[model samples]
Target chain A: MKRLSILMLLTLFIMVGAVGAQDAVTVTWWMEPSGSDDHVQELIIDVFNASHDNIQIDYQPQESINDQLRPALQAGVGPDIVWLAGNAAASQYVAGGFLLPLTGYADAYGWADKLLPWAYGAGIVAGELYSIPVTYESMVLFYNKTVFEENGWEVPRTADELWSLAQQTADMGLVPFPYGNATWQPSNEHLMGIYLNNYAGPDNVYAALIGEKAWTDSEFAEATDLLREHIADLGWFGGSLEDYYSLGGNDPTAMFASGEGTMMMSGTWMFRGLGPAFEETGMEWDWAPLPPFSEDADMQVGPYSYDLALGGNLGVNAATEHPEEVGIVLDFLLSDKARILELASTTGFGEWVIPLRYEIDDFPPGTDERVLRFHSDFAETTGAGRYGYTAWTFWPARANQQLWEAIELVWAGEMSVEEYLENHAAEWAQDAADGLVLSILPRE
Target chain B: MAFKIDSRVGVTSAYRWRQILSNYIFLAPVVALNLIVIVIPSLTSVYISMTKWSGLNQPEFVGLANFERLINDPIYWKSLSHNVIWTIFFLTIPVAMGLTGAFLLSGIKRFQMVYRVAFFIPYVIASVVNTELWRTLLHPRHGIGAWLAKQGIEGFDIRVFGSKHTALYGVAFVDSWHFWGFLVIVYLAAMYQVQPDLYEVAILEGASRFQRFRHVTVPGIRPTLVFTLLMIMIWSVPAFDYIYLLTDGGPAHASEVLGTYLYNMSFFRFEVGYAAAIGVTMALITAFIVAIFVILRRRGWEI
Candidate 1:
């Protein structure tokens, strides 16, 4: 009877607290600014506040946000809205029970149909929604159109043609891919995902992601060897491995702009810099999906698949005092498609591009044609059940770190790909056991 | 009469005790602050060091497993060894440069302030700016290396940081460039207080400039010298920023030190428990360094 009375008393207190909180409740969100003004967030937040009476939205722009949020989340206190690097990052928070499942909110808001399926699915961990991918991107083959035309070179569509072009370009004393890791060490993974998806095929890659296929499989081995040989042994990636490391930050990007390389395989984000880079050198540039790089039909890219990435993810904090208010704020943020498009258009369409469902014509007037074409291709391909995973977005944190860093050790000849894969499998196994591995959406 | 005398003595003792209590009460805020920030965190870290944590996940108690893994980890040993090398480099090169600059500046009367400012500019500038300046200036292709090569400087064509053999030393050189200036200012102030009569006596005895520097100048600044040694020892083991900014301990962990390694483990790899072990080990190493310095001072080595 005493226990029952204590429970009753606790319930009464909670009810009273809820009633008190309903008046003048403030829902807080911390976000990294998209641009100087962060017009998208500012405009939407202003609109929300103007529409609401007591529930005010508190949005704070932050830098070094992951570092800030980690301690806050562990202490069971933070902004009502939790920002993370991606869905892969949310796995840890999900494991800790720090993130509130957004499924109820998603159902209430009907966000499942509102976002791109791949992006919406990226937010699901352990068969439940825990995050929402705010920004989405993909990797593609950026080529010097001028260089291709001048040399009468065809854009390679298969493994043979790609290697032949690489050889021919190297023979002429030029960088083929012009890829290097000096500026961003994780650039290693950009090429890794490209080769993995293109050479091993997205299906095999997805199988490994879902723990059905092993990292040491023959196709993966072939991909690793091909990359290792091209980068270090054959000296085709800019120069030798050392040369690649020594490529003074943006030298490869500069080289691409100067028409020194046949192509540079990189992210859509590269478009922002490419215009100025090409302008300086009077070079015209274009892009296509990175081609299939395997002879086996099983390993070839079926139709097409773009390697996907999210700049970051947002989840509601489970420990927050105001879950309902936070959900309302999230619904507004995701639903405001015009604000997102405006931000994308103003920011030149990379960092501020949210993964809401879109039509090509919905883009405001003066949207770049290249941007539209990419969207059209991505929408059509992904709609037909074709998409690949970027390591940063899909791999667990440790595996992601190892994926990039250990590859350098292999290239430097300190470790073989077999040894690296063995370690990778070990890390993946631990992540799997710990429930830190993210659920990859099933292929159609 | 004897009872009254005993009562007076008791009162005096009680008053003394009260005075001591009041003194402690005055110290309470600072003590409380230390307990909150330092003592509590240190104790928590000890607990964390024993567990397997991924920062976000509930730390699973694995008792000394992390330490065992660290002991068996070659990367840990390699990183630790780099820290030691970094410490040795700072102790020697910066100390020598600082001593020489101080001694020279002390002797010169004209443009002393100008010389001090010139030497101190690198130190005074923000670390990012200083690092960026060196990163661009020493870049193999874009910087002086390429320019020198064009001017028929053949051997300088090599990449300083890209090579595993030279990466650690290259970072150390940049750090020393930014750091030696502060050392100069400290050593120069000490040189000023050194008895000028000793230098006069050395000069009268027909001592060479080098001899004066060795005999009078060196011994005169022994306290400052020892203090700087202590400072550099503590700072060098955690030497992160310049190296982190320059190479990120990279190419292939060629320039990896304990600090960068710990950071990578903690944040990048999300091996918080393993990282905590590394952190505790570093704290122990730092304590040992401080202990050595304290012991020497108590033994009157610096005094």
Candidate 2:
């Protein structure tokens, strides 16, 4: 009898082990290398794995995720989850039927209430949610505090003040806006967004995006003219088109840090490299929202709102065999506030796009105060509905590309501002008519 | 006796079949590899050129539309023109430099091997490293240009790769610098094979150095010269890495080459079909050049 009982127990144990083995599912994820910290993703994966037993997350870091993902997905063999740059990129995957609709996952995970309204809306295409944003960015005017104080240059708040300062700086044999577009042409879009939103105002820009207003409208043409005049007058980095094309990301930042330039109009992504760069020069830096393009009272959006962008938006593959497990992995990655705070602390600034419910105090101890303040200010201002469109995050892909190329032509004097605007309007209208535009929220 | 002869004939036939089979067995691997890597992909690319594919979804059939777009696209024409310019520059500059270097080196008796190795160093170095070296040297701010500017030299202060007027030439110059040395080694090998008697006869006939080089060396290396010219022409069609790394065909399509343009269209713009069409166009150009060479050869031209 005793021997029979022991045998029964052994059999039961074997059955349970087999069942547990069958329950285990490994989810594959391909992510681009995080610019801030390399090991933070590994650490996140480790924590998530430790917290769960039924699911194993396989983390792979790819240098060029889109380039690799395209062929793999085409072969009907891709990772369970892919980290995309933004909704603009995710929409392409969705259109190709490569990405699974996150609508069901969003509901199950309570993502709608968790994410910012605009961010949540941005990920939707034709009323279907497709991506969950993991990082956010915005272009702003970064000035050297030391340089400004030494030169008695007040930070510009209006278009007149900004241009006045630019002219004065040019007179002093210094660059006003140390812009560089050589390495990455798409960077031109950032400057365009700033000028368009501030000059033409967000409403006009939004209207133009949805095909309700023409880009050839006087406001857009004026914005282009303003940008062209600035380019001609200032001539970028070293005061020539050659310098503008030759200067890369680091060159202009280095110039600003060393007081060779007064200000740099760039995205918050620059923080990752700028911290180390500024360390050498002991240059203190601060960011301000871009100045209004005009002081006209009719331009309602200027002086209040600024361009906002999201990065590192991610989605699950429709072809993934383990959708449930992939969802669980994504939930863990997006919702683990403690791990997210830890990553933010290590990186010295938060590039992560967390739910608005998380406050600065929720961050890990030893997180830099300045970085926290920057995030907090942006969040508060954006939450208050004082935010505009960023081309990379919001514009349709073709339109966004056209914007960059057209701006280059205008700057090079190959195309007139009117012609550039007309071309943009035509392309945008076609895209909008084809139902290619992503969901966008109107400014309140 | 007749039956015995029939058996012997059967054995001889079997032996012949076995010999043929052994030859095929030896060739099997290489033939299979070529079919898999080259022939299969090339055929697929030709098919893909007729379809609209973003490389993510089902490729939709859109016969001739991509080609039509390519014809209408100004950027395509512009990039093709740049490739033509690139071919001309490589044909003239690198070929001249290589021939001159080979001729000068062939005449040298002391430290000949040292000179050969020294010239070949740049060719052996990775293109990325070579491009970076040139970028730094040509940089407007902290490079030789800046140093020269401090000495009151003005022209060097301007950016080479940045200017639309100069970007194509600047990139071609860098590529040529890295490539000309390879031509030097090839030409030198060909030059060494030429009999010394021909040169001696030319010298005896009171031929000047230039005359001897033009008359004897030129004729002797004609085959090599033609081969290198063909290679340069074909290679120039697919010239990508240097231009891609240096300027990325940017600052308003100033340095756009067909290779970089096709790459951008395929990857960045997601116009894979259009890019494949461009590829087909390039292949046609290569084939035409090859056909011309074949016809010339058939017509009894020495090359």
Candidate 3:
């Protein structure tokens, strides 16, 4: 009996050792979710961990990704996965040797084929892939259909129609576009990108972006002038520029839903917010592509052109202990398209509108058709090479900064459009000389 | 017995040395922490000020270039001027308000605690909450401005925070409203420390209420007043959070301070060295102000 008891004890010890040895490698990835709940990260991380048996993920939601990233990267240590605000931000990390070169992982996973071509190329730095664009977005016009119906307003498709409608809206004592930068100062770039694309024409703006033409050209000047007229003088935005500056982000949505404003021009990211806002107000909301503000008949596909933007990117940290595990995680995130879309359908599309090939039919029952429609519109517009560039994605940091901040001066009429463009050109020139410019994807 | 006493005295000397050693031993952790977190970082920042860094790469030295750029930068000068205006406003208006409130409250014996608590509530409230409260009340369309306009009040719908002329003042006003209660509480405590007999004597001498307060109360709280001033002056160098949260130094940077400029340069533009240079300038300005106070004290000023 004693011999049997000793043998059992030995067996139990051996079993415990084996179990301890089999523990999965933990890969840490901190998420900066749009919502405080971290619901998207919770879902994705849970699914990824369950599917991958050999590797587990430790999810941490950060309050401020920028505040945390700056110190952690500087210290040669950070989470296994990195979330950057944009592809441009990822490039800064790449420059600092804080991000891993993902060329090998891309080859192994065929990431180039899996992602949209431009999305795949967005992370390339010094001819090496250092980041991956997890999400692609565009600025769009979201209008209150309830308000539109009440006013008998039709969605404008041309420069003349848009101005006439704006004028009408203004005359009715309703703000034409209740836009502001009170919450996010960089929001000015959204309008800047819209004006230059729809007015300057996507092709001309593209040429200017690639340095084929100067920004001080007549087209851009006209766009700038049009912006000044509508935004500054006409006070079409929130009754006056003063009122506009006073308004926060949610205020515009509320104003639109409550019929105070007929329309609000904002980014696709606001898709998540429109439902609850409209539902509460019992107002129907719908979106239309920002129509081309150009008079040129020669410009092909003038209407329905979108200002393409990369919302954020994912990169592997160079200091990560489990690089191999991180690669599997990256592949799971990027390649598992069906699951991602399912999650997006479950969560409702906003931050998770990734750059993967979408099977829109695969969305579950009772999905909001409005979000799905924007995706459809976006893909169709970009596919036809009728896409413009977002200043955040295309312009280098300082130049992109000037694009938003310096426009305030122009709005105040302290600086002329010509001078503003010149300043923008100078910053762009300096950024280009520093090799900080992103290699833009050529229009098809 | 004499030899034994000498031996005990020798033992006490060794014991005193041991106690001294233990005090340092107890203080070692805190001292080390301060060195690591504050002193070392401050010194490193001084070095960083001279370097061209992106906060991502190793810093490259570029002596005095950032300072030269800052000198030429109109934005920096604009921000500095706003900061000066903020300091002047804080020192004058709030100090006067605090003195007046505390003197009036000190005279009230009944519900004094209630009044103190009520006045102190705003100070204890978070800056974010205070800013939001003021923002809602001051909103051009949806707030009091709009309501007054609805009642047929002309020009009451002025956008205080949105207009360039009033943005800085608007933010400063909100910040001061939050800060005023703290000053009142502090002054009230100092006023208590003044002798009751001195006020009685002032009354007997036929001093008016204002005269009594001016002569007796002010002189008695002089040290506390000077201390508060010194703190405010020093604090002004780093004054940013309220302004940043409220206006973000916007409407073309009408409320921009040195702190916001440093933050933008460091984080947004990734011009770390330039930001460090701005930080150094702020520190130097603070040091210079402190030196003035120190000089005053050295020359036998009571404060």
**Of the candidates shown, which would achieve the greatest TM-score relative to the real structure?**
3
* Predicted candidate 2 versus true structure: per-residue lDDT over A1-444, tens digit per residue: 999999999999999988977887888888887764365556677777777878878888888787798878878888998888777667777878988998998899988877778888888987898888877777788888898999888888877888888888888888887877766767778878888888888778888776688889898888878877777555754466678888775788888888888888778777676787789999888878787787675765536675778876888888999988888887776776777767755555446645445677777776656667767887888877777789988987667778987687788888889888888877677556545678887767
Sorted by lDDT (best first), the order is 1, 3, 2
lDDT of each model, Cα atoms only? 0.84, 0.82, 0.84
Please rank every candidate by TM-score, starting with the best.
3, 2, 1
Give each model a TM-score.
0.92, 0.93, 0.94
Tens digits of per-residue lDDT, candidate 2, B1-303, equal: 555988989988999999999999999999999999988988898999999776655688999998998888888999999999999999999999999999999999999999999889999999989988998898777889889989998777768888888999999999999999999999999998899999999999999999989999989999999999999999999899999888888778889999998888777656687789999999999998899999999999989
Tell me the deviation in Å of residue A414 in model 3: 2.5
Each prediction's fraction of true contacts recovered: 0.60, 0.57, 0.57
lDDT string, candidate 1, B172-289, tens digits? 9998998999999999999999998999999999999999999999899988898889888888777898888777788889899999899888878778888889989999999999
Q: What TM-score is obtained for chain B in each of the predicted models?
A: 0.94, 0.95, 0.94
For model 3, residues A1-444, the per-residue Cα lDDT tens digits are: 999999999999999867754878889877676662355556678877777777888877777798788898777668898888776677677778899999999999898988888788778888899888766788887788988888788887777888898888888899889877776788888888888888888888889978999999998999988888888999877778888788885888888888888877778877777888888999998888888887786653655688888887888899988888899988888877766776665445666767887767755567778887888877777888888888887777778888888888899877899999998899889778767778787787
- What is the C-alpha lDDT profile of model 1 across A1-444, one tens digit per residue? 999999999999999877866776899888866553456556667778878876888888778787788898777668999778776678888888889999999999999988888889888887889999877899988889999999999987767887898889988888888867766677888888888888899989999999999999988888888899988888877756766776756688788988777788888877667877888999888888777788787665574578878888999898999898888888887887887788777666766678889888778888878888898898888777678889989999888888898888888788988998888889888888877788788888
Error of 3 at A314 (Å): 1.0
lDDT of 2 at B182: 94
Mark the regions of model 3 whose C-alpha exceeds 4 Å error after superposition: A1-22, A36-38, A298-301, B1-31
Worst 10 residues of 2 chain A by lDDT: A347-356
